[model samples]
Target: MAGILSLVWFVGSVLITPFLMILLCIVFLASIGKSLGVRRLYVKLLLIIFEFGRANIETAQKGSNAEDTSEEDEEHIEEISPLNSNATNDIKHLKTPNGLKKPNNGYVPNGNSVISRDDKLILVPEPPFTMHKTDETTDLSEAKDKCKDYDLCNIFDYLKAGMESIIEDQVTSRFEAEELKNWNLLIRTNRRYEFISWKLTVMWVCGFFVRYFFLFPLRVTICFFGVWWLTLCTALVGYVKEGDFKQKLNKYVSVMCFGILSNAISSVITYHNEENKPKSGICVANHTSPIDVLILMCDNCYSLIGQSHGGFLGILQRALARASPHIWFERSEVRDRHAVANKLKEHVSNPKNPPILIFPEGTCINNTSVMQFKKGSFEVGSVIYPVAIKYDPRFGDAFWNSSKYSMMQYLYMMMTSWAIVCDVWYLPPMQQNEGESAIDFANRVKSVIAKQGGLVDLVWDGQLKRTKPKKEWRERQQEEFSKRLKVE
Candidate 1:
């Protein structure tokens, strides 16, 4: 019963569709003709349709007679061979070697059947195609409009011929402009527009206002309160407990709190860590923002090693130390680079401290690409664990462009968007090859993280960021201007 109704419905639709289309077409043509002041629109539309039909007909007839072999055209013809009909009946299965699924008795597959024979089976290539030439014509009404504007001057010139010379200079400029207004000569195949500085300035100003109004309050409410909470908990725990166990416990608590803080900003956070990997190995990860530390800490307990930046970010770093043994080194103490390396080794060597965490990319990258690892981190040569950090910019960019945005500004940008999210992969510990220099080992580990993190591997050494390029315009080099210097 349903089938009969469906068939009736289908037939009724088919019969009524053409009539409805015809009515719509008449109304459309009447409107077009009314606007154009003529009923000649049909002629123009039909000509366009005919031109399209002719092009399609030419293309369909391109290679239809490819195999013709008349004696007059024999010079272009080549010998042809037909494929054997019995070849498929003799096909063999690959599993025959294991005696599990035998090929059809006495039949075997021949892979050579797929190979094309150029001499014996020469197929004629299709003829080159040409596009239909257009019959388009430009309207001349604009030129008439220009003449109307000039007609007023003509009235004055006829009254006094000497008066025309006085205004000739003004008239000539307008005439020259009008003459080439519709010309297509010296065609611009491509356009190269130089930077418009004013537009950029306007965008920056607008962004600042947006951040201040929309995102700043939410970020401060979350980050400011969250930091104080972490500090209070860590201070309470750090002072009361005294052993290596206490520090590990503090790390575990810090990781949990920070992880929750991370979730507050991001919609999703994906963490992948190898179960059997050691808990206290030195961790080297890609640097995107300060949040990289928070995100990873949420995944596992790790003691952070970094330099303190001035402003709110610096204060957050100091507070983090109360939670666990976080090492904050100063670059000005170049004499202490070696000392810091020793401390990192000591932390990893000790049984009580959480694993040492270091972002080899000293500065924050936008997370679209990776920066080079500091060779100093690799010098420790302990069982090195590489952790890849990646963020989805769909919610908010994870990069901290310190030059343009302070920590306060960046945090607001992050929270105002959808939740901040990241993927953390604790890759296998890199096995240092014999005679491998510290630089090579660091690069090798860096490559593993970049691959696992799904990021572009860069050759830039982040450690050199302090001295080279001067720090005045560092954000440009990191994001926009250094595009040419990027490694594939």
Candidate 2:
């Protein structure tokens, strides 16, 4: 019994001592808001492994293709006969670049169709086919006269475009995960290259164990302790008198607490143009994930505005509200735009309070593009500070698809991924021009962000992820079709 007890005690020490040490180190670094350069080093190591894996995948694919070519040749010889020459020609004529035979309808295959990385057919419509329309319209008889002159071939363009949209749409793809140019060895990523080589397989197995078993536990420990620390610290800070000292303490506490939490994902953020950081105005940014709040909070404190949520998000929201002037509206209250605007105006009127951080896009995008920004925030008439955040997909996917995954599941994926790497840029402050509409102002800000971040500027609303396209949009498309038939 004595020998068994000694062995058990020794094993426990061996397992627990390193974990305790790591915890202490993380806490110390988080408190000081410093890093030991380990994250960048780890990223660099990953790039090397990824390069090796890519080489192996290429080599393996070449060998496999050679074997497949021989087998295909033998099968082709057996399947064909001298009398089937015309059938073979017919087959070749039907073949498309996508490797699928086109339907036997009158629609001719067009060059405008592109095959995206995910094997989806992307139809690049002609610019004149856009939904935007002018005020000019012709009389019914005049339109009829033009329709008589319309070329029959033009109708095929519409048919092809419609079919391509049915296969895959431009808007829906933005809500999905962004594809990576090279595989990063994460199973969750879009590519599956781990099985191509034994070296990659071994490396992937080790990485899986490290991420799920070691990194995940460590991250959860840091996050759990960090949450409690934030609650306690905020509670203590709330007791301080309302003055500059309190403000300074609040900022310090927010940065330190959020810094600790961000450490949970081993986040590596690079901020540019710090001089343009928001001081006393409405701060807007493109949303990719809930981590955007944590990322920005680590650098500077901002009064957040969002609808109230429950569960883990709720705990964080309640904790934050304790120390800062955050606005969390109930679901019903959110629909009252006037009330929300009044609150926003009141908050911005106070010079001492931090600038209210708002994500005007209103939903998380896949980080490849900036969707339409809601005009409500721009209508406030305050100096708008635009922020752009772009994540490196080669590291990990940062987009959150709420419809498909719950908050806890999303967090689990995040915690188990390699790391979160992103860049934040603070562009120059913008204001709505005189006589300019709110929508135009919002579009102007969105364009600036999309340009700076090298993201595609999309005019589509982000809310379309949860809702169908408005009925009027379909009607407008019909109107455009009628106009297309009009020769002028």
Candidate 3:
């Protein structure tokens, strides 16, 4: 019986202890929650008090604007504080950052600075210290009488006393500052987290599609959809990423259509040697917009060599590796210049992908003027085809907004615009000679385009300029030649 009782007691203690511990934990969490709630309430109350006090002070100042100075004097006395003359000299000697003298005179010294009988310097501790205007206007007897009553100076004293009170109130309300700091930090953290989440989601979704669906049949189908689908996809992505699709689309469509139209027009309008046909060469053009890619891709046989921005985009490029033959470049791959050059060389060498499209301008520029071309594309063994595209007068104003206009608004502007026009001039292809440098070749091509396309001023040679031949000289020369022939 004793053993059973002991065992029962032990069991009861073990079970009850855990329940009590859990209850204690519950109480601790509840207490913490209550404390935070009280702190939040306190901060809100303090803000309300500060706002109310500030408003009341402003209202009081306004109300006293019409009050008579004499009555104010009757209410309070003015205390005259002596200024130290030496302190004033010290302040005047102070220098500014630019080695200039201090603007305001320094504090008074020796407490010997005399106060005028009418003009009393009263120090009011409130913001924008107050000054009472007094002169011959106040009766001497009345001024002396008012100066004796300290209560007459109560207005200035009240202003001083209220200032200290306001400062103390502000100190008590510091919880508001803490709350605002915490709120801002929370918002910033949330925004960062949201962006990270969005990037992760995009990666996952894009990866899943490329890995599973973007295989043989699907890839072929995507290719067949042609420029329109590519444009739509690119526009959709730009819209999602930037929240502006219309302007980007417009710029894209305009540049692309211009290229196509220019090519078609040139085919009919331009004359060329049919027998000594221009060999297939890499077309190097200025890259003003992403639509430039589609324009080049219009020739289905021509493959693209693009630098891939990693992750899902890179994976997508890899999946279409055979079809597109893109040069997959990591963002960090810029550190390895040789690797990039080698990749470019390999892609350009492929016989199947002749005439690689290269944007030698390096970056997008306004369509008005062409930037200097980068020389990397010229180094490729293939002949270089220089093409100059000029937009029609109407679409020349289409520049990407770096200021007030957002992407979406820009897109809308483009969609509303009518037809876009452009001129495409294809210069003759250039072959690399044994001793010719890339820079020399580039300059030579640039000169040809500038001359033939009216890009530079034309000058005529003196020998080519002819004046009308003298009729008498011509007749005399003919008669002499006939006499010489008779003698022979």
Candidate 4:
């Protein structure tokens, strides 16, 4: 194939007049002249060298005729080899100039042996010139003394780093837009991405002010009133009818009322399989935010079970604890998981009990996926009812990344949005299959919920998603330092 391609290329080049001129000139000279173009000069040079060599040989022969035969024979006898192959091999390697010696090749290098003791030991030829070198060793003590005299710090280096960081972050910022999209409903409808998209910088700035100054006051007022109204009615329910049939009615009613108030802010709420909503039994739901409670309880009230969150939400949970059957398990009791399970079992002792709502993902996810479920809720021998909740972030992101904002901060951002839209799916009751362990049962329930709600099923245990803000701070500074170096 190579020969064929070469032949075709040669023919193509010969077809051109300039290529033919160069090619034919060389061929014609080589065929008819005494020598080819370069060969003609080489022949003249060789003849001159031959003449010089012959004259030198004649002069050497005339000079050597006076030399004694006896001295020549004695010198030859001393220099001759004695059938030693080892000495012959050394001679072979030594004859080849610039041959490097291996450390353990079982041969004396450069004939550094008795046979070549008188011979020069020129292993490698001396270099033409010595390289000019500057001293590079750093003296810490001297440097410290110098620094003390003039306060010589790395401020210049720091300035260079910061400048590089600013430039690098600016240059690459355009490409780091929300490249992964449409993976789930969350990503498909994320409007908050305006803050990140390079093309939407101006629009985002405008939206920010419009969101805060124009729409902030009205939403906060509504949220403020809803909080108090929900609190009072909840207190009234608990006080009027505690542990009776009327209490159940009041609890469900209060939840529905809270849901209605929340729905007023969002302007959109819908649910499926409202009939399968349980009055009492273990109820597990996918959690995305604190608002998940209101969404799930829109139709049926369920007692929440989890550790209490801090801040405004924590206070709200505490207030609700006095009114509803929401149980905040003590997280410090690490040695008493079995005791905790027993307590959980006791909570659902009654069939008429308000169905205990368990957000198995202990922490909220970004609605990209349903995170792993804690098996404690499924461990109880009750029929586990599964619910899937999904939100449309086209109007607002309901997933609260609390690290960047407080509860009030997040809620204000949410309420002032165009609207919060969501869907609830109350999947069919999932019972533990024969001999299925609690983890297996929980996973089964989680998979069904993820499938039903168009959510991704992630394998991470949500409990392990605790924010390491302190560690990440150090890492962030290091990352910034590295970015600066990269740009430089």
For TM-score, the strongest prediction is 2
How do the predictions measure up, each by TM-score? Answer: 0.51, 0.82, 0.35, 0.53
lDDT (tens digit, per residue) of candidate 4 on 1-488: 99999999997676455533533453343223222324235334434533443344334434555365446544544454453545544444332211223212333322123132112112111111111122446554443343333222324444444443343321122111111211111223233333333333454466557556644654554456566766676666667655676666566555545653563354456678888887788888888788887776666667777675776667667667766676676667634778768867887887766788888887767775676788888888888888888776545567776556787777765766656667888778878999999999888999999999887565556644454325664675556434423411
User: Candidate 4, clashing residue pairs?
Assistant: none
Candidate 3, residues 211-267: lDDT per residue as tens digits? 234222222222333223334444454434332354343334333333332221111
Candidate 1 at residue 395, lDDT?
34
Clashes of each: 6, 0, 22, 0
Model 3, stretches more than 4 Å misplaced? 1-281, 299-301, 309-322, 395-412, 450-488
Q: Rank the candidates by lDDT, best first.
A: 2, 4, 1, 3
Window of ten residues with lowest summed lDDT in model 2: 106-115
Model 2 lDDT per residue over 1-488, tens place: 99999999999898779878987887788778788988889888888987877777667766767565656655554464242454344333332111223322322122112322222222323424322234457245543454455677656656777775665455776887775445678864323567777888999999999999889988888889889999999999888899989888999999989988887898889999999999888999999999999989889989999899998889888888888899999999999999889999988888889999999989998888888898889888888999999888777788899999988889888999899999999999999999999999999999999999988787888898789989987786677566666655
**Model 1 per-residue lDDT tens digits across residues 81-176:** 223333222222121111111222321211112122222101121111111123345334433344333234433322332332232321112111
The TM-score obtained by model 3 is: 0.35
Off by over 4 Å in 1: 1-219, 276-278, 463-488
Provide the overall lDDT of each model, using Cα atoms, as 2-decimal numbers.
0.53, 0.78, 0.40, 0.57
lDDT of 3: 0.40
